[model samples]
Target: MKIIASTLLCLALAAPAHAAAIAQLKQFVSSTKTLSASFSQTVSSKGKQETASGVMELQRPGKLRWAYSKPFEQLIVGDGNTLWIYDKELAQITKRKQAGALGSSPAALLAGSNAIERDYLLREMGKQGDVEWLAASPKKADNTFESIKMGFSNNQLVEMELGDSFGNQTRIRFSDIKKNPALPAANFSFTPPKGVDLVSE
Candidate 1:
């Protein structure tokens, strides 16, 4: 699960750095209860880049599903209590308590409570093309990423870029976003398949 873990942890660590962009983020978070979107992600390091595509769904106060159907298959789910990471190719599943798995990270920004200001420091990055940008870093030390930036258009999250401690960068763009969608509870639940290895932490 190295690939999947690194991909998600790096992206999760990014936060807005600019204060001007907070308005869009605040409004979006305040109004949005559930969201679904198709996303494309790219990770670049030392002149090499890898790309992946996936679909994601999340409901506020903790619940999410990230389904990767690209070069390989992986599924990450948070059922508001436990977090599950399933790698289909390896037939392995990793599970952890949701509180320890997510905390106040970007996952919380999307699906957790609306207390972002307590965990992240937001700064103004002005605009990048058509998207208004915000940059963020955690108040507490996070070795995974040095900084993270988010792009918003018309108060909707459309892009995110993350830079890691090793100078690696990951960018994700969301398309066909549907806000406040009716996501069923089962979408966030997970169960290891028969004979699959399970690691509980």
Candidate 2:
């Protein structure tokens, strides 16, 4: 789940050739029924950071599954409009409606029928320290995310940073990405156990 969230930040920070890359990615994701990729993430909370690595499987029209197979095994699945966040260690699952978090969700943007021009007003910015950057703010200012900043190296998305409504930030970097690959349909479906206590948030 964090991988997909991070990946969305990656998409948000489209490269200098972002228009072209997004154009290609749009065609790829829209046309393909399933796509898979490998990802690595670093999440920070209270000045401490934890690193997790995993693979992601996504189906268009709102089906996404993220498997954290390293450090620990965790699963987060979004079946169309419902989201399930499962913690293997605690043996707990948290559920939420997709629309509630759509404003700041990565799956919403990556899987939606939207274009760069429609959602965001693009800006060409100069370098921020050592990294070259491109900043994009949503045209719909009502969204929970304030802006998405994409960092590029040699025209590929090496890093992405996002600013959300609560002033919290999430940054993700991708490596050895395999785009538009085959994925299992089962990756997006969920069959929670009977007594897991489904909390409606």
Candidate 3:
């Protein structure tokens, strides 16, 4: 759970080669104002792997909800201003400023209002079958991720791989993605559960 939690921020990196890949990525970013998808996530480290499945919803300019239901239950919400992480089994909720939590993370690239080109250097990593790949590295020096690779098929984002300096990798596959969906404001809002410990940062 901690691996997933920590790598959530790493879910955002790239270089250039195929002009088509970059174009497709830019198109997806520019056209996708809101999105919803079912995701399967894998985190790998030192020959071990952990997997989880969940649904995600997000609106551009900073708002997202990630609800995990497999292996355990956890919720991560970014309500424009604040980021909240709720661990159901432990009965604890952790919070921090949204901007501070995201920085140049992949979540920022996906849900943030900022121009992606300004914060990341995009590179084309060629194609893997039908999926065109692009890589990104944060322009910021203090970013947590070492790099990020995204795969797009038919100009739609379908996969993401994130790497960190510690040799850990997280891979996420999105399916049944609905672009420009009308997401409810409630999805992005959070209220700490009664009797749960609240840790604010």
Candidate 4:
């Protein structure tokens, strides 16, 4: 759970220092009800970098499921209040309160509220290469990440580049996104099965 907790917390926080781009992103997300997308993730920490490809299902107002399929299979689900980490090989289920998952965590930005102006400071950086970019920094500092940059392609969020307090950076790019659909209810909630290990984080 330590690996999942620490590795994921850094990947989720929402902090932006820019505005105009945030508005476009906000409207796109806020207006949409549900989103399902596959992602290419690159996580860097302690000067080391690794990449993983995964699928994500997000429901607005606080629910997300991040399923990783590369290198190894893993699933992390957040049910508004509780966070669950499930491991395939070990058949292990780890649980924790959502508060601890607060490092610019994906949900802090993705599911909670799309209105960046409501909780984050937005900075419009215009464009970077083929993507339009926005910098966002949260109004609170009790979280882990210092800042994050979100990249848009034709008004939709295509990628998120993050910067943490330790100077570690991670970039997650989403593609093949589909919106407004039914996602399994189980994907957002966790019920530890019997006989498997249950660790509290």
Q: Using lDDT, give the best candidate's number.
A: 3
lDDT of each: 0.75, 0.61, 0.80, 0.69
Candidate 2 regions exceeding 4 Å error are: 1-33, 126-133, 140-142, 152-156
**For every candidate structure, what is the RMSD over all alpha carbons to the true structure, in angstroms?**
4.0, 4.3, 3.5, 4.5
Provide the clash count, candidate 3.
13
Clash tally, candidates in order: 12, 1, 13, 23
lDDT of 4 by residue, 1-201 (tens): 122423342121122433346666666655666778887778777777777777888777678788888756778888888888888767898888876664345466667665556667888888877777888887777656677788876656777887777677778888778776798888788778788898887
Assess the local accuracy of residue 54 in candidate 1 as a C-alpha lDDT between 0 and 100: 87
TM-score of each: 0.89, 0.73, 0.92, 0.83
Give the per-residue lDDT of model 3 (tens digit) for 65-162: 88888878999999999999998988999999989988888888878865989999999988889988889999988898898898877656778899
Q: Which one wins by lDDT: 2 or 4? A: 4
lDDT score of residue 25 within candidate 4:
68
Against the correct fold, how does model 4 do in TM-score?
0.83
lDDT of 4 at 17: 35
RMSD (CA, Å), candidate 2 to true, equals: 4.3
Name the top TM-score candidate.
3
What are the clashing pairs of model 2? 13-150
TM-score of 1: 0.89
- Candidate 4 residues lying further than 4 Å off, grouped into runs, are 1-20, 89-91
Error at 97, model 4, angstroms: 1.7
lDDT tens string, model 2, 67-156?
777778778788878878776766677787765655544556665545555777656565655555667677776887786766655444
